[model samples]
Target: MMTPDEMMTLVTENALEYGPKLIAAIAIWIIGSWVIKLLVSGLNKVMDKGKVDPSLKPFLCSISGIVLKVMLGITVLGMLSIEMTSFVALLAAAGLAVGMALSGTLQNFAGGVMILLFKPFKVGDFIDAQGYMGTIKEIQIFNTILKTADNKTIIIPNGGLSTGSMVNFSTESTRRVDWTIGVAYGDDLDKARAVIKQLCDADERIFKDPAVVIVVSALADSSVNFAVRAWVKAPDYWGVFFDMNENVYKTFSKEGLNIPFPQMDVHLHK
Candidate 1:
């Protein structure tokens, strides 16, 4: 054991070396936390001002805060003279492993970011994509949620949605509704056209300027088909179509028009 004087000298030297570093590290930690809070708040305001997607704002903020805090931790460790070379290398290796494991998820995340940025479709829009038709309920980080007409919920991954073909029905205010109405051969063509026009005019949802188009589309085996097309508001498309079909069924017979069906006659005699 060393003498009492030697012990006192060693202790004094050690305290001189580490005392200031500990105090500085504590002060830096406190200040760094406050700075991080401010930076995160500023990011939120910037995103809001820039009209960034609301669904993506939180995710960006969380990532920024985590990165800032990690940097602050490293700064504090460096102030205390802790060796960080091996730690940083280890961290990089772990990050690489995680990246490899979650490659698909990362792709989905990137897709989600692109979708949020470009905005091909928004919430409440009726869309057809990947053989599924539904209204967009929510857009998430890795998936999108849809609400079908029948009240079923569908979850689609963002990766495919970003890169695949999509049809947005709600993108337009008006849509053309087409139908084929057939009558027996030799029926009044002018009368069929007039009936279709009346049906279209009766519904206020149908457009008047474009005018209804009724023309002889084809001559089938048992009937002459008229192609009936009308332009109507998107919301009223199905309603007007169904109403027109019912009206035709009711009015055609009274108007002396026969709805025909195919008949095949086969004769075999001895």
Candidate 2:
């Protein structure tokens, strides 16, 4: 559309205008990247000195690096003299859309952060929460993994886990194991109490300081119920519970203590 000389002149002018900016942009990018690396390294050291949780360190570093890289990108764009107003506006819009779409995911991410910081439960602690009971295996960015007693693995999202109610059985060193023992209405109360006391004393896991509590809780139609409660180390809870039940059953039989069962008489008239 134009003479060759004119076209050449126009091209030269355009190159003169943008050439330096392009080179400067590239140099800035390279230098900014190196600076970002140094900053991130320093941040890691600071976190280590602060004794931040091991699981949280890498996550913090990753987020810091991403934010720094994004800021570097903006600086490079400015060096190129590219208009940032529209670009920033478009970026904001896109980010808003993406954020809306990933609302639940974002909640999980926040929840994970809260949990790592607050430390409601750590790995290997036994917990009952969200209708599942298992030992915590790993706490990840968006999920908490659990290993069940039968060796099954469970994955629960952090959103509900962080906010919901949880029972950490391993939090306390001692736990109370409760049992309801019943004897026949006519059974010897003193003998039953002595026998139950002996059984509890035989188990070394049971605590002596708190002492054992055995009381006649209820007298139902079929039997007199004994509310037997004992304190034992948390790790020995289930073992002591099952063993005591078995021993009580066998000992009561050997001692001729009758464990009453519900019975009813039915009559028919012709």
**Which candidate should be chosen as best, given TM-score against the real structure?**
2
Off by over 4 Å in 2: 1-39, 49-51, 72-82, 267-270
The segments of candidate 1 whose C-alpha lies over 4 angstroms from its true place after superposition are: 1-35, 53-55, 75-83, 104-118, 220-222, 267-270
TM-score of each: 0.77, 0.79
Residue-wise C-alpha lDDT for candidate 1, range 1-270, written one tens digit per residue: 999999999999989999999999999999999999999999999999988899899999999999999989998999999999899899999999999999999989998998898889999999999889999999988999999999999999999999999999999999999999999888888998888788789889889979888999999888999998889999998899898889999999889988888898999999
Which window of 10 residues has the lowest lDDT sum in candidate 1? 192-201
- Cand. 2 Cα-lDDT: 0.93
Residue 200, candidate 2: Cα error in Å is: 0.8
Q: Candidate 2 residues 119-229, lDDT tens each?
A: 899888999999999999999989999999999999999999999999999999899999999999888998999999999998999998799999999999999999999
Best model per lDDT:
2
- Clash-forming residue pairs, model 2: none
Could you tell me which 10 consecutive residues in candidate 2 have the lowest summed lDDT?
Answer: 47-56
